[model samples]
Target: MKRIKWVLGLSLVGVLAVSGTAYALGSGASGMMGQTPQFIRTQNQVGISKMGYGYGMMGNYASSNGAAGYGGNGGGCGGVNNGESYSMMGGPYNAASLGINLTDGQVTTDDQALSLAKAYVQVLNQDLSIDEIHEFNDSYEVELNESKTSNKAFEFLIYKNGGYISSEMGPNAMWNTQYGHMNGRNSGNPGKPTVTAEQASKTAQDYVNQQMGTGYSIEQPEVAPGYYEFMILKDGKDFAELDINGYAGQVWFENWHGPMIKTINNGSTTK
Candidate 1:
């Protein structure tokens, strides 16, 4: 059975003014140093139906077989990109199929994905609510918050065809020092790391420059548990997002969000 991270000292919500987005700082020994915190809540509470991705409320799909649950369908929380099973570390897993049955009218729309995400989080026993959802080519990235507080909690990926959901890899998994899958949902203070935020930023720049070549710029870093995240920009727009390990200095580029088509904020508040 997979465990859930029960966040502590994050109940007190404070307003962080950043480009008009609301972010709150989590207090306690687990808190990271600085104002830019992990708990974020964007005030873009728009309805999904009005967003017009064309994926309206699909249907109430009750999977008695339990294949729609988290890590179900024998994929083990891995993702499918370009029709291939990918490991969390960013590599091909195998040639096996993702075991998704794309039945007619069973496609996972934003609304359906939110339902699946809510159910999955409920099983984990965390008091989280869906904050925003990003619809990519192959999956849906659902960001959760701390109920009424609206403080950012964490994110997970739900496949568009099958109901396979898992914690987002990279920073959300590997560098999350306090809670979540990498920490086994265990509570502990991962003291400050040797690598500074500036160093990690440079590390990201150097890595991207070497791999993706020049003309790529790194945005301001968002401090998470044990990693710093940056939006890699090309022509002053989001080209890709990457994370740097605070301790080991490893870089992981996000390859999951394939050409985001639509987005919905405050999805849980709907229906």
Candidate 2:
């Protein structure tokens, strides 16, 4: 009986070796003998809705087996091992890496309106001393009426020596107007005489021309009774204008005034 048992054992060992060889050789029966009994059900099982690893069958197998949480579907984070991955939360790293240096008079096209406004403020501060300037933060509600032919005007106060002495808008200040009157007012009447708008315009133009050379010309004449508007025209075009108040009324010149004149001309040429 012992001999028979030993023969049976030897036979079993030989069969196992043959089966292993057959499996290695790609035999179906041999493969089945070599495979774990649980493999077909576990490895072939479908994973949860979404999950996978490293772009391979083994990863999918792992996912299906529920060994990998979330099945490595990558979801919103995109898929891992699905080529290059990027972070939505992390902004452009290169942009953050660069340092920005800002200084005065640094011209940039970005934020142009804001830059111009800042430049205007800078010019004011630089041209006028702290004692000669008073800044007020104010807001205006502008109502535009198409039927009314009126000038929508504003006044900016100018302080000198701690006193509010004058007001100006685009270089047409009260003091400038007064100076024009002192120099350009008709000598004929100190009490009761009429002065023409043309005469006032001529006077203002002559003053500007004399001071700034022949490059200036009158673009708009002051049309009001006592006020005169004169513009400095350059290259056959109006660059900046000034309004003069004759005794009481204000004069206005259109589109021919301020430091922006040169900048505007330069832009035109470039365009």
Candidate 3:
């Protein structure tokens, strides 16, 4: 139900790093590029089944129409629809082939989706790790490491047939949700924060002062996924709402939502 209103923009160089070698991903990335269609996993609760390239944990058969709507809007997050790397499998794959009719932006199971998404992240940036993943109406959205600012992080989506839909790199920069603070958002771990509510509040206050120049007030930073979304107030006047990277402390001021809005893939978030 919550929505992020910013774009995480990874530099062009960062995107091209993985985009150039679109096919070389996963376990056999190097050798399997032109040789054969990369096969996905068929696993169950116990673990990955010996049987290779098959259905996922959820019954392999379900009726889901392909409808994609992912990538939330938040300052510093970059997103692409129908991204490059069409399909991980070289060829011969469809919802029917896998015994399911998948709706875009939704996932039946996390492990099944992660098995497929992890490969993509690994190839793009070995240092990066999948921090979260969720099923949307028509696609699976995944976010990577929080080591840097949100704008500098890596995130992407995986299509039904195991194809790389789109990728987001380098979110602009914003404060992380300072959960637990008296004035913080309701949902978030308040303890051991990398950037505490006090820090974020100060960050907001400092930014507002610098931008507006004297006599600016703040309404407390609220947690939104990777960053905090809050408003800067100047005599009840809306100076701006800023989103800042919870860690790196990068920032930007932009919030324009289209017909469909997306947010962090914190289990419940969708596009």
Candidate 4:
């Protein structure tokens, strides 16, 4: 069994022109504050089913990087867990080990578990598109716990796709495993581990202000900084600009897990 580590980083840079007309990027209007887009795909109608175990531990945290101790096993472009091996579905034990504790009809096999997990990934790919789905693969990992007695745990990366995107590991995974437990002892004050909505909003605003400069209304700007990229939105329509970070090099924001707008640098687009 190998321990997998998930690390998220914001290092991608993308530039898009702001076209006033609203164009659905399949993200719907959810990215916008209000005003749902004309195109709507309901979950029920889409027939998208949940994938993997719904347990908070697995769903919330999964490793993405290549590490030893606990990590995911790749197969058919998907992943699964082996004995004492961690995976996205969550399990420190293999099917046979789990079967020991369950009643006659309660337990399932590893193959069955893997099948269910793959099914969920299929539905997610359909809804989010293959590109988005692949993007996520870079962030999550499912593995087993080394301790025979402990259930499977997860390690979540802060970025959306994988640890490759955001440099910070997610708050959820960090608190439970490392920060919460010290030398196998329960720390008295394991602070709550959740990102507040206000905090998300402020992060977005700060990123924009720091790179784009303050006081430049989203609508009109005195001088569009050639260095920093921008995702300008107006009346629910949005477009992005490249070189928001001065365009000396490219930066990938694929790890910006939240819904906030992003800007990446892709070399000099200015004089």
Off by over 4 Å in 4: 1-169, 176-196, 208-271
| TM-score of candidate 1 relative to the true fold | 0.51
Question: Which of candidates 2 and 4 is the stronger one according to lDDT?
Answer: 2
> Could you give candidate 2's per-residue lDDT for residues 1-271 as a string of tens digits?
0010111222211312221100001111222222221112222212112222211211122433344321111112111122121221221211112222223322233233222323333333322111111121111011111123432222222111111112232222111322112222233333321334554455456445543456566665533223444545666654544554444222222221122222222122210
User: For model 3, what is the C-alpha lDDT against the true structure?
Assistant: 0.38
Clashes of 1: 0
lDDT score of residue 231 within candidate 3: 56
Please state the error at residue 189 of candidate 3 in Å: 30
Q: Which digits, one per residue and each the tens of the lDDT, describe model 1 over residues 95-146?
A: 1233334455244555566666666665556677777676766567776667
TM-scores for every candidate against the unseen true structure: 0.51, 0.28, 0.31, 0.22
The residue-by-residue lDDT of candidate 4 on 1-271, one tens digit each, is 1111223332221100111011111221123333221221111111112221101111122212221111211111111211123223333333243232323422133333333323333432322111111112222222222234343232212122211111122211222333211112224533332333332233334334433343322323211111122334423333222111111111112122322232111211111
Q: Whole-model lDDT for model 4 versus the true structure?
A: 0.23
RMSD of 1: 18.4
lDDT of each structure? 0.48, 0.26, 0.38, 0.23
Q: Which 10-residue window of candidate 4 scores lowest in summed lDDT?
A: 14-23
Runs in model 3 lying further than 4 Å from the true structure: 1-107, 146-152, 160-162, 169-242, 245-271
Evaluated against the true structure, the overall lDDT of model 2 is 0.26
